[model samples]
Target: MKLYHHPLSGHSHRVHLFLSLVGVQHELVEVDLVNGSHKKPEFLALNRFGQVPVLADGGTIISDSNAILVYVAKKLKLTDWLPESPAGAAEVQKWLSVAAGQIAYGPAAARLNTVFNASFRADEVIARAHDILAVIEGVLAERTFITGSTPTIADVALYSYVARAPEGNVDLQGYTKVRAWLKRIEALSGFVEFRKTPVGIAD
Candidate 1:
């Protein structure tokens, strides 16, 4: 399997964390987002949206971080990664939803905007981002991991973006429980670190 990704992408980090946890071996092919290499034909064939975190399993191609998580979890027969039974699977999907939906628009994108000065729908996007964080805090308070007693793809999906929130000037200071959960995820065996996106002037 080959995983196409950027080292600094939170979305990519989520997949990396899962691969490590599951003891899955794969090659990493860096996607040069800065140069827009993801838009080229070779990458577009793997992901029509030209996104990082694309995976090639045998001849199969998978995109979107959450979708990749599901595909990997299912392929590995790691029920803990995605669980079985209708309710358990839906609960897993809920965290994946938070990862792809809220994390993308909120903390992750906010960090890109406020730190890197990327063009975004600033006020509208960030307001909604903060709203998402508020809900996430509530979820964090009830559990060590996002969706369950044990860490799963949900936790992997959420951890990186929230862990690096302050870099975007999105203060995580008030989310004590969430912050604790972050530390817990970091302490796991075989856990690799997620780097703070390079610090820079807010443009």
Candidate 2:
């Protein structure tokens, strides 16, 4: 398998982290987002959306961070990371939705503004980050992982951006449970660190 990605992208990191956590050996093909490599014709052929983190497994092409997660988990039969039952799948999908929705526009957007200078209102996005963080903190207070005791793709989906929310000036300090959750994820075997950048600056 080969993962085409930009190091600074949380979306890319999502797939990268998962592969590492699962002990899957793969090549890393860095896409130069700064030079608009992802939008070029060759890259577009891999993913019409021109997004980083396109995964190529033999003849198969997988796009979208969460979709790649599901594909890899299912392909490898890593049912522990992604359960097979309907109720279990629904529970994991619920947080994946949050990862794509609230987490995307909230903490992710806020960090995009700071790290990449993407044009999003700082105050609005930061507030949105805290709002979701509050909810996550509350949910985490009731259990070990997002769905239950075992870590799932739902936890992976929510990990990268939320762990780095501080870069967006969305403080994680107040959310003790959330902070503890981050520590738990970090402590997992084969866990990989999401590359960090100073707030309001590129590295």
Candidate 2 collision pairs? none
* Residue-level error in angstroms, candidate 2, position 197: 0.5
Stretches of candidate 1 off by over 4 Å are 198-203
lDDT of 2 by residue, 103-167 (tens): 99999999998899899999999999889999999999999999999999999999999988888
Per-residue C-alpha lDDT of model 1 across residues 1-203, encoded as one tens digit per residue: 88998888888988988888778898999999888999999888888998888988998999988889899989888898788989989988887887778788887887788666888776666676678878878887787787868988888889888888776667777778887888888888778877655652221
TM-score of 1: 0.91
Regions more than 4 Å wrong, model 2: 200-203
For candidate 2, the per-residue lDDT at 196 reads: 92
How many residue pairs in model 1 have overlapping backbones?
0
